[model samples]
Target: MSFNPDILDIISLTIGALLFLMVLVLIIVFALEKEYYAVRKSLILLLFPAFFLIMPFLNFPYQDYLLLGISGLISLAFIVLVMPFNNRKKISDYTFSNKVDERDIMFSRIRLEEGTENHNAYYTDRPRNKEIDDAIKANPSLLSEGSTYYNLFQFASANASFDTVEAYHDHLYKDPAPVKKDVDAKQLSGYIKAWSKKLGAVDCGITELKDYHTYSKLGRSHNYGSDCKLDHKYAIAFTVEMNKDMMAAAPAGSTVMESAFQYLNAGSIAMQLAYFLRSLGYESLAHIDGRYEVIAPIVAKDAGLGELGRMGLLMTPKLGSRVRIGVVTTNAPLNIDKATFAPDVIDFCRICKKCADCCPGKAISHSDRKNINGDIRWQIAQEECFRYWTICGTDCGRCMAVCPYSHPNNFLHNFVRKGLRNSYLFRRFALKMDDFLYVRKPAPGSPPQWVKKNS
Candidate 1:
């Protein structure tokens, strides 16, 4: 069909105007989001639409047809990108039968004194780790003054939060009330989930306790090396978000300050949930920091909270890895939430290696997921990560800070997340756009003004 020149001009002008406005809006959005790189990139992008806007006025023959053809190609690309495809498998489709031994975790090894019997026994059992463990221990410890990014006020604040969390350890478990209170499983589950949100949890879910969820041995405290005795039938898992501004300054004092506070926040919420359950004549135990019998990320995954990311942390739908996890296991009868396996998270992680690129410790794996204990997954080098933590005197959150999924949970980002979840082609487009806007490796942000005030 022959196209009318007037109609073609109008359509071309409309497309150009829309493209210009979109780029303009993105510039403003990037500025508001504090992404200077994106703003600059958007400024450059304005030229693209500017050329199209003037295309109609040019003396060149068949210009209208060219513009129409270009618009058609763009529309076709958009449709292809938005179509959902390659949603392969649920996270549970993989098998992981092996139980983790908590005694082998970094935290457990860090607590072992050089001359103590526990240390000697552990070294005897695993002599290969002795040299590396000692080297890591030799570094200036987390929050200690002799390390990078030391700030007296920030470090003290973090320590105080950690100390307060430790205080909740004693209240993790309590005897059921003398008079049993019968409750409806579904109703109680709903109540607990709602109450958890009221107590600062970003999300909460319950799952039937599984054997792989529990640690084979106790890791920390005086009862170290003892067999784990947890026999709870249900596990309630929740997450509390970390402040994006605070965490942006990764490996800095403010980052640890925020991390510590969130740990305490999550722990306090878990303790309250456990206490409330026990009062209702249900036996429950809060799995706080340094006192966990359960593998929290696994429990959180099973509870439908989030999926595991390449950095070996739970990547929540809203907050990504920028959150602290809390768990409370109990014998209380409760309706379990079916774990909604997000193939998008896995698919995105597969293509996006930003975390690995930004990791200061080089701890995160750059390769694809491997068969880890029968389940295909990416595993970070824990020793390398912890060693860097010791050196920095902070849990260097470089990986979390740089993850595209770790962007602030707001309308602008949520819109991107929606597109990310909907289409595999959009995932590739989104990644490129993200890299163009935010850059592949963003520098660590400065701590808040208050964190630097006076000191």
Candidate 2:
């Protein structure tokens, strides 16, 4: 059999052209997305494929063998990336026994005025936090003047969203109707899931309410120090996405504006769901911003929403931490979704410390997950994080913005995410590629043009 040099040349050209086109398209997308670093990196990468395209023109001995080897390697790499692998871990492995006390949370503690009865009493119980809390209090409050990124209009816009969410507090819980509607649990559950998507939710799920999911005590509002008596059997959890462009600005005023707006959107959805459940003759409560009896992340995770990422945020399959959670607890009989237990996400977080490295507050830990009161997980320094938030006048979403998983929910990134879940080798390769193309530490992107104009 005669070896066809012409055929080999044709094959090589096709491979080279495909590679070049793939990266070229990526460059165009990056540019459109305002990812300058990615575009720059892609330009440099084009040279590699260029060499392949010109390989036939260059006279070199063993060139045919080299091309054949390269073709084989490419095929093998693709197979390795797409192959299914078992790396899933159970949620029970990292479950925590300690139920959180909302009173101890930063939002709760910050609301306590110094020298007031509640403040004095709280510090008396946890004297160690007194100094730390006081230090954080010394900084300018969030969205206030003197703090970084304190734009009057943007902050006001954020406050308006927050105020609206606060209004929902009074309407969170309600009694069922006099006549209970005859309904199948499965049908109702399916209806709620489908309807929730139409109500601006990116994803929705259900889970039986667990003890640890509830806060030990109520913290915000007039219910301070009271035990959270939520006895709802089922929780409906859903996520509303944060605008990617706004979040790309991280600690900027635009980010907080988007955050607050999403919170309102989340709250609105939750309230509607709660009201609907009540009308169906089921007691229900909507847990939104400014009023939460249950921990949103834990509930969301149990509802099969997502795994807990290193930043101590709910890393949804599509949007990662770029989301606000809305949970509605009800006595309504409903079907529950199987909880998602993705060890691949955790494993990726272990290796990819971009969040930790990019944290301006130095609050996120670079160390491995530790056993904290029986829970094996990474815990951020809340005081340090809140302190930065107070000074910044924003939630400082640098961690979320830089997360590889937080990339736009599109075909290209979704393909990468699929590879990440399926194979460990692809995870390593993807991480390396992410670091190279996007840079290990990406700068905060410019705010949207509209936001800039307003500023």
Candidate 3:
């Protein structure tokens, strides 16, 4: 095909026009979202039109082919430069053995009635926590009228989902039927992964259950008296993507509604996984929503899913902390991915304390990671976080919404993530760029149009 000069001119103009339009759209969107950094970046991207326009004037034979080759080479060079600084490593030297006492968690303690055996025993063991506990008790409580942003309708709606999730707790722990025939481990794993995907899981991973994953005692529900002893040998952890539109309304009713909806989605997936394991003659238990016997984030970390971030949430490379986790504890033998701890993520969190800055309750820590129960981790003030939730009449997720890593799971963000994973230089550069594009403490955006209409 002969390359006509007019055709080349037309193509260049089209490209430039599309680029300009995209930049304009981005600027308007950012302005509405109140994202100053994004607005500035969009303005910069608008300059790409000049380069696109000049391409036609410097017309050479097979110009498109030459441009493609140059682009590829540049990308390759960028990757090569960034690869060395990626400090992802497996830390076999550090091992966690402390069994978490479930009674220590706020949820478990919230369910405790004053003067009850469980409550008395809990207070007897940790007298220092009693004063804080009493203070939390003094509040009107979640789903109560005294909350600052209380919406009785929304609170009730969320409670309905929680009630449904609680009903499935017993079914998850039930014993399975006998396996009459031999089963393929790999095939079963693939099946579970596919099934989970169909059930709305964005990612799935498996790991051998460690003693540190399960809590030492039963917290919440009627199982308060039971000792925390999970005999399961393996854990299946999965994540559900949070809706960006809904999450943009952080610390609001819409955000809580979205959170409740995802919890139900995760709970359904967990219940299904446990039931499937039971059908295969393997013992399994689903830890979903309010009825968790094990720490989901810890299991998720061991499963090679992601690292724990500053907000004390699982920071997956793809979705960051804007994901809901579901875990199924089982005895079903399966292949496990080696746990990887990305120093880059930890480093980024250190430099980018946006979550701490944007936290409404000041629950996130401003300090470095500490040795909590033998593992180096950031400890958030759970009492304060939950107290904020009760006051707001919602589980305020401001930290999750404003995180740079919590950008929508799309090509543009993933491209940035690829660079971030390959190079510490890129990680640092990206963080700075992110802060420039999205403010270090971006304001909470409005809910989607649909949500507003419904409300």
> Which lDDT tens digits does candidate 3 get at residues 189-291?
7888888999899989999988889887777766775887789888999999988778887888777888888999999999989888888888889898888
lDDT of 2 by residue, 315-357 (tens): 9999888899999999989999998578888888988999999
- What residue runs in model 3 are displaced by over 4 Å at the alpha carbon? 1-41, 44-84, 87-95
lDDT of 1 by residue, 56-165 (tens): 67668777677878889988997888777656654334434789888788999999988889999999999999999989989999999999988898899999999999
lDDT of each: 0.88, 0.90, 0.81
Ranking of all candidate structures by their lDDT, best first: 2, 1, 3
Who is ahead in lDDT, 1 or 3? Answer: 1
| Per-prediction backbone clash count | 0, 0, 2
TM-score of 1: 0.95
As a whole number from 0 to 100, the lDDT of residue 341 in candidate 2 is 79
Question: In candidate 1, which residue pairs clash?
Answer: none
TM-score of each: 0.95, 0.96, 0.84
List the candidates ranked by TM-score, beginning with the highest: 2, 1, 3
